[model samples]
Target chain A: MAMPFEARYRVYWHHTDGAGIAHFSRILAIVEQAEEDFYASKGLLHVHGRLPRREVYASFLYPLRRGDEVLVRIWADEVRRRAVRYRFEILNLTAGRKAAEGHVVAVCVDSEGGELKAVECPQEFVEAWKEA
Target chain B: MAMPFEARYRVYWHHTDGAGIAHFSRILAIVEQAEEDFYASKGLLHVHGRLPRREVYASFLYPLRRGDEVLVRIWADEVRRRAVRYRFEILNLTAGRKAAEGHVVAVCVDSEGGELKAVECPQEFVEAWKEA
Candidate 1:
């Protein structure tokens, strides 16, 4: 199996809640950022904004605090004709533990005539994954 | 089974992405807001921030845009000794459809001496759910 693509982020004040830990909702945003970086690194920036999430899930194992740096790793676990499922893990480098892990299923859609129509994955996306 | 508690929210510019719809990450925040409202309505405001999510999941069925009013309904689907599972639905009142649905599992914890220790549900929490 191919190694997962990784991206690094620092916990910011905006990402933390009153509990002084990164808000659980921010975990999804962090993973999505890693996904974007992965696609951009693969020169598939055109794929951005074309795929919207159909479903997303995350499990929080540890708390992450502001100023802490985290490493996000992502894998294109499943690539289908019309969708892709990306699995991601957010490792708290400061604490040396997994902070959270999740998967997002995004489906390709074409927004033409002000309507969103489900579409097959772009050829570029398929080719990018094939190369990865 | 009892009727779920409901809260209303409007999609704002901050909640939207370049896709012109509410960002998927915002869905979790929206549901959490509803959960907070539910607890507040039950006079269990102390429960806020005491429960951190163990896992969360969401499925988006329709898009919600800026200026759209949404009705979020939440139910304490399962209340255990140390955790609560909340099921929620986001209804797009403007579009008259289910925009998203999800569940969050939060476990009770106590932060004493700077350590997060899993603890039993508060008496107030148990009493609140029992009344519900």
Candidate 2:
């Protein structure tokens, strides 16, 4: 298993509720942002990608209360011929508790309607993530 | 118990995932929108409300699969001295299944941080929702 890349963020007002805790939806937003950042860090800029070459699916496991400084740890769980699995775990850094955990599955295609051949994890990308 | 107001919406691309189903967070988004619509339907514009008079809290009960045409039914469960409870139910209109259910709890407070007195459900508001 590879060590997940960690992203830190503060609980902002817009991300919280009247009770002063982060809204549950905002946690999903944070996780999605971290996933995008992970792909962008690997030179896969989703902003320009077309043809639905890759698609992400995710699920929520738990809620993150407001005022909790959290850390999102993410990793590509597996890379296969057509699909890649990414896992996530959100930690309550202050309390050192596992607040949430989930995974996303993405499929790779090509610019055209045809499928891309020979999918392999980039050595540098894998190494960098494993080191993280 | 009163009948809940129902809101219907299509599952757009922005609201779905690779699995072609609506994302969980998007469910929350719809519920929030319906709640706002309920208040606005009764002539209460949240955009202008100040003094921290009322606040809302929500929780998720189940997952809504993508491509699922959903009907979000919302209603005020109760109105007390300082709190209002709103309940929600997501129905799979096609399969005729109860996909999810949850509730939101809101508190009423004054502009200067004082508590509001004698909170009561406006008749027009309650009647409107009941008819809806």
Best by TM-score: 1
Lowest summed lDDT window (length 10), candidate 1 chain A = A123-132
Number of clashes recorded per candidate: 0, 4
B27-110: candidate 1 lDDT, tens digit per residue: 779898887887888787778888889999999999988999999988778889998887889999999999999889999999
- Alpha carbon lDDT of residue A25, candidate 1? 84
Every model's DockQ: 0.90, 0.09
Q: Write the per-residue lDDT of candidate 2 for residues B2-120, one digit (tens) a residue.
A: 56777886566788655345565666678777767777776754521321212223333323554567788987777554556677887877656766666655544333232233344
RMSD of each: 1.4, 9.3
Q: lDDT: which candidate is best?
A: 1
**Which candidate number has the best DockQ?**
1
